[model samples]
Target: MSKTILITGASRGFGKLWADAFLQRGDKVIATARNLKDLQDLSDKYGQALLPLQLDVNDRAAVFAAVQKAQQHTGRIDVLINNAGYGLFGAVEETTEQEARAQMETNFFGLLWASQAVLPIMRAQGGGHIIQVSSILGLVTLPVLGLYNASKFAVEGLSETLATEVKQFGIHVTMIEPNGFTTDWAGASAASTTPMEEYAGLRKAFSDSATPDSFGNPAATTPAILKLVDSAQPPLRLLLGKVALPFAKSVYEARLAEWDQWQEVAHAAHG
Candidate 1:
């Protein structure tokens, strides 16, 4: 059976890739982008299967309005993919107030607004799925991506809480924690703070660690997404690329070891 899927940031990257995939498989996709023009090709190809709308996810009111319009179009949305965030690259101290706030606004608050907007509709329908496009940085840290890491970490916390809260309503929440993919995420879509001389070595080390295999092909993720949305039991979190799992495992193992080493000190604080 075909489902009605609403996706944000449908102009390009994973948003566009998944939208095209869903439409190809006969699902009704309500695609939202900041510039509606970016979706014209999809609209031309898919006809009624694609409903393109202009949206800036940072605008809370507009997000709610867009959700309402999408619900009216399909009567009930079976799934929502919140993929409307960008990367903010910088060292923690180098980040400006405006940049940090903007990162949270779109990446955290934007997802919050969209989640809130769809709740009433999904509740009325008795079920739905919400997929948040988080990153591997959400689980672990990387140098020179402090703001982006913080934003994704916020997404993880919010979405985890949301999953527990909405389980009773039969609304499933999943965070897609993708590692570096061959998308424009690190390219034109990324915003960077002015480089500080102190962080140059750190940046160089980070850049030097990259191998061609570190990034996955975005197109290859289609099947995983399709299966996730169609599943009777979807995971609370899904890692997209090959690198994510190993990276997460290493990070978490180290975290556990450190926590255990500090357990006595941590426990003493409670007294």
Candidate 2:
């Protein structure tokens, strides 16, 4: 059955790809970005199947308003893809408090606001799925992007708890953790704070290794996401791409080692 799906940050990157994939599959899409004009081409092609809206996810009132408007048009939203966020690049020490908070507003708080606005709608509609566009950085980390990593880590925590909390309502929450994609993610979509000379070695390492497009094709993720939407029992987390799995495994492995090293000392405080 065709569903009403809402996609935030639909102007570019994974969000745009997901929008295209869903519309092609005959679903009704409400695609939003800060710049509604960016969606005009999609609107012209999809016509009534697409409703393009200007939405800034950080605005709590606007988030709720957009969801309400969407519900009025479709009567129910079956899926929500939260893809409205950007990567902030800088060493942790290099990032000013303002830059850090701005990073959180869009990456962390934005997701939180969208989820809050949609939950009641999903409940009233009897059930739905919320797909969070997280990253492999959520599971692990690197230099320069520490703030961005922190934001996605928050998303991982939020989505996991959301999954358990919303199960009774037939709602599903899946965090889509992808490694670097061949999208505008590394260029225009990413913001860098003031660079610290002290972190030049780390910056060079990041540049040489994790420069986004160096990963591979991002189109590979669309089908997996559709699978999640079609799933009768979707997992709490869906890691995408060739790099995603290995990266996740390594992170867990390291975490296990660290836990093993600290378990006795950590347990000592439990009393």
Candidate 3:
């Protein structure tokens, strides 16, 4: 059966790829972005299968309204893919409170709001799925991307807790940890706050290393995403790309080791 999937940030990158993939597979997609024009071409191409809408996930009221509208279009959303996020690259000290908060607003709170809005509809329908497009940085922190890393880390925790909480309601949550993809994630279109002058050297190095031109093609991960969407029992976490998989594994192993190393002392104190 064809499913109704609502995807945020559908204007570009993995979001656009996911929307196209789902449409190709005969799924009904309610594609949304801050600027609907970016999705206009897609809407023209896919017709009814792709319902394009303007959505700024950061706005709580807008998110609620959008989800309500989406539910009206499909009666129920079979899947909600929270793909709207931005990358903030800078050292912790270089990033301003406002900049960090803005990142959290879009990447963390935006996702939270969207999920909250959709949960009621899904619960009423008895089951649904939520896919969060997190990053490998969500699992591991790297230099110069502290703010981005923080957002993803928060998403990782939120998704994990949500998975457990929604299971009884027959709703599923999956977090996709993707590595570098050939998207405008680091080109002229990428989002970057003004870096502090003190860290100019580090920021320049990061910019050179993390540009979108250097990443692998985004098409590589679309298939995996479509597969996860269609699967009867998708895992709580889907690590995309070869690079992301190993990095995620390393993070998990290191976390486990650290926990194990502290377990004895932790338990002794409690006892």
lDDT of 3 at 247: 69
Alpha-carbon lDDT of model 2: 0.89
Candidate 1: tens digits of C-alpha lDDT, residues 1-271: 9999999999999999999999999999999999999999999999998999999999999999999999998899999999999998889989999999999999999999999999999999999999999999999999999999999999999999999999999999999999999999999999999989999999999999999999999999999999999999999999999999999999999999999999999999999
Best-first order by lDDT: 1, 2, 3
Q: Give the 10-residue window scoring lowest on summed lDDT in candidate 1.
A: 87-96
What TM-score should be assigned to candidate 1?
0.99
For residues 160-186, write the lDDT of model 2, one tens digit per residue: 999999999989999888877778887
Q: Which candidate is the best by TM-score?
A: 1
Model 2: residues with Cα > 4 Å off, grouped in runs: 211-214
lDDT, residue 109, model 2 = 92
Give the Cα lDDT of each candidate. 0.95, 0.89, 0.88
At residue 1, candidate 2 shows an lDDT of 93
How does candidate 3 score on lDDT? 0.88
TM-score of each: 0.99, 0.96, 0.91
Q: Which model scores highest in lDDT?
A: 1
Worst 10 residues of 3 by lDDT: 207-216
Per-residue CA lDDT of candidate 3, range 148-210, in tens?
999999999999999999999999999988888778776644566676788888767766676
Model 2, 200: alpha-carbon shift in Å?
1.4
